[model samples]
Target: MGNSLAAIGARHQMWESTSDRLSSSSDSCGGPVVSFGQALRSAMETRDDPESLGTSSQDLADVDEQDVADSSRKSSVSAETAEKLCTIPREKGLDAQDFRCAMCRKTIGGSTFSKFETCAIDSKYYCTECMKSGGKVSIPARVVMDWDWRERAVSDRGRAWYEANQEKALINIKTTNSRLYAHAPALEETRKLREKLQLVSMYLFTCRESVSEDFRRRLWPKEYLRSEIDVYSFADLIDVKSGALQRRLNSLLKHSINHVMTCTLCKQKGFCCELCTVNEVIYPFNTESTHRCLVCFSAFHVECWRTSGDCPKCVRRQNFETRRAQVDDPHNTLLVLQP
Candidate 1:
């Protein structure tokens, strides 16, 4: 009876183990096997509607475009602001129409246009012509007595007289050795006479001395003598009556200095050395002293030719000669046979 009871107990244990295995298999098989991709797809499909998704993307794109447009508008506004900041304001009370001559009532245009400034003391605007006329208008005391009085005083009539006298004076100085040829004295005296006559002419013509030092420099450089004349020696006897010295001095100053050729090799701008012409490296067989290539008519320096060997385009023509000479040569044929 004990043995039978033991066997029954073993059978009961086996039945419990089978029941657990069946429960585990049923649990695993009961639910559908969903893959990671399918689960993600289902989640996404449930969470978002197709129309809503498209609307979201469109909204984001619109926002991005709006941001870009806003940035562009800001850049344009900044550019405009920079331009406005950099622009210079026009002078007050002065317009394009106000630039005309007040006395002659002629439109001042191009190079003849006169620039005017209001006198600080007088508080009146004066054109170059009106100022030169020496009318009752008040002018700066400094401007009237400036060093450029000779140029400021010259008139149309005075200019003609000066030109004629200047020519005479130059001739007289050149032909005869006189005290007038003594350099400073002659030049200064001529300038003084010209200045006096110019002042008189200015009063008679334009009435003011509006011509500046710059205008004088451009128009009459001879009227102002700043340096000592180098054309005459003190030992030379000069006639004070004849204006020979002045003419000689003017001629000497006006003479042009001789310019020499530049070297292509040394890159020197002034005169080239005679020795440099024979230099093989500097003046190559194919290159000229003027920096021109003899073969192709192109230009290059000695240094550039050294690195490139020969003219880039012309060197190809030498290949046929090289091949012909090499093929015909006995030494090349021997070397080819030995190799």
Candidate 2:
């Protein structure tokens, strides 16, 4: 951009000098005067300006307008790069894939042997938490030194392992594609349903830890809480039906709800019933009570909500439903005639 600006200003200055010289000389030779462009070019050559002294009309004409434009574009790109990075990203040479996270160093791909637990933000090569808030934690100088030393110890491990297991990875990819193809007939309807929704899944943003923990006993049936339970593989052991799964999830979310997506009616930023009385005597549910409206995702106190089985806060949905059902009937079926 600086180069571009210099180039433009140089041309403008040359033009101004040319015009001034032409006008100044035209009065002296009124009958026969040199061409304004010629006088401008000659005047520019005589001037001490850096661009004017050696530059010719030919050089000015040959000035690549594209180059000047490209200079500005490059500057813009650099600015965009800085904005996205926000903070300087710690550089790495390792081909970090599903093995481990870049920030927290957690595993991305867990399976039976690996037991991968969560999803990765593939675009940024970061975990979701790392993407939300940059992983900037203070550490001791000694800890940093030790970590670097340990990392260096396994510097070429990723490359070496990938080289050796390239065939295995290829085979796994082929096997996955083949298995997915085999299930094409079964998953066709499911795929269509997902497409219809525009890929948006309305997941309950409730307490995940407590909900997952609640299913631990059912998963094991007999094993202790600390025992390593095969959750995905041995999920059938629990015999929880699909509807039961949704019900359990909702139940867990309702009871353990805290700072969920938001409170719908009150429009607060947490899992709370603002309408519920603060006093212990008035509010019998106390800290343990919670209610969730699956329709509108609103929650209120158990006692306050009562057995109404209707969302007190879903007036919008009710209006929408009413409008949708309102149709012109010749006999006036929906409304009673005033007559």
lDDT string for model 2 (1-339, tens) is 466546645755655454343221122222332222232233334333556346677776787989779978987865543232222234342344546655567555434322222211112244444444332221111111121111111112222332342222011112223343234332222223222111011121122444334534433342211121111111211122123433443343343333222423111222334345342211111223655454444445677678555654455445444543443233436444344
Off by over 4 Å in 1: 1-160, 163-170, 185-258, 261-339
**Residue 289 lDDT, candidate 1, scale 0-100:** 39
Candidate 1 C-alpha RMSD relative to the actual structure: 39.0
Q: Report the C-alpha lDDT of model 1 over 44-108, residue by residue, as the tens digit.
A: 45335545335566665667777889989987865553332222223244344465543444454
lDDT of each: 0.34, 0.33
- Best candidate according to TM-score: 2
Minimum summed lDDT over a 10-residue window in model 2 is located at: 225-234
lDDT of 2 at 243: 37
Query: TM-scores across all candidates?
Result: 0.13, 0.19
Candidate 2 segments whose C-alpha is farther than 4 A from its true place? 1-231, 234-268, 271-287, 314-316, 327-339
Model 2 — TM-score against the truth? 0.19
